[model samples]
Target: MDKNISFTLKIWRQNGPKEQGHFDTFQMKDIPGDTSFLEMLDILNEQLIEEGKEPVVFDHDCREGICGMCSLYINGHPHGPATGATTCQLYMRRFNDGDVITVEPWRSAGFPVIKDLMVDRSAYDKIMQAGGYISIRTGAPQDANAILIPKPIADEAMDAASCIGCGACVAACKNGSAMLFVSAKVSQLNLLPQGKPEALRRAKAMISKMDELGFGNCTNTRACEAECPKNVSISNIARLNRDFIKAKLKD
Candidate 1:
């Protein structure tokens, strides 16, 4: 049976993007070890509502770790201390009784905090809109085996396609660079036949948009890969650099 534990939560509180933020302490007692991190927050919110106090604000959706909406910086790690997992997947069992857990929003210039733990991650969407898709139609959907993609190449593309746009890379990076995210998106599509025609243009446009949005340049620190929930590789960044340089050379 899972035992209940107690802890102190020091969560960041902010009214708006421009407002100053600070930590608000809350005591959580007798929490089930199996309770998910988000479930614990829900219990706290319920307690606050019953007491007629304002509740903490945070972003979460599809708690199954797919949407990447839970942008929590828990104890200095993006999405808690769990490896290859999102915040929603984190459980209280990871911490011991009476531990002081600190929760904060992603502290990047590109991902400004909206209120408390929620930040305006629309910058990612904007970067995607810049050139993350293949506009050219590859005709009607055909059989999966028709394209004749080799196993190794197809596997690499699938791995790159696993990026969920969580922005954990930005939060973990000392330079707040989005190269990992952007590179994953680029590699997934560029590796396939349908996206090959415009691979260079796609890479160039997305990178330009990332820079225009004030995201920092990649400095080879590889912190982004270390903290990425999907473990998106920095090698993709190298591929992005090669593609970008090729595009520039053509110009």
Candidate 2:
């Protein structure tokens, strides 16, 4: 394979959150196959800079796929061709020489576009701030085997812990439901002993915050799990519903 491959990029450009947006086409020639997707965008920005034009801005941090900061909808997919992959982890080699790629920001009313491919995901942080953390301190240290939790229970908690709060679930959902995300958050803590103290309150607070943020209700279409970079399970949603029901019963 040639190290230098040429391609076409149709990128979304919006001046601000309030401004109307459109796609701008640019033909990239002799690009390195080794360059990551974001790196390709970097080169394109450099070219625009040399021409005395404004650079394209996109969100990115810790490109290693953990931070979930690379919030982008590339070629009709949340991240790109690779499943459970981040934009910064995507390589140019995934395409042929003449492939025409469409790059856009995550589209959702709750997440207004901040720039070209960057949207304000502070909505997630707001939801978390509502009651995502365990406030009570368990200062006294106990033995590791004191709880004797089953392996399966611990595994479920780990699965929920895998959620990175990427907002891909909202972007992929037609109704913009954050059910999968909220479910994962609740599941991680609900299944464990440490989280039992705040289980009811946590669900009520986070769900209330989610509605206040203007997110839509979950109808169980399952599109979110398909696009999620973490591959968060839909079963977590059921787990969340159970917890919510239990909380309501206590009231």
TM accuracy, model 2: 0.95
Would you list the C-alpha lDDT of every candidate in the order shown? 0.94, 0.89
Clashes of each: 0, 0
- Report the C-alpha lDDT of model 1 over 1-251, residue by residue, as the tens digit: 68999999999999999998999999999999999999999999999999999999999999998998898999999999998899999999999998999999999999998889999999999999999999866679888887888888889899999999999999998899999999999999998898899899999999999999999989999888888888889989999999999999999
TM-score of each: 0.97, 0.95
- lDDT of candidate 1 at residue 140, scale 0 to 100: 90
Residue 87 local lDDT, model 2: 83
Candidate 2 lDDT over 197-246, as tens digits, reads: 99888888889899999999999999999988988999999988888888
lDDT of 2: 0.89
Candidate 1 regions off by >4 Å? none
Off by over 4 Å in 2: 1-3, 138-140
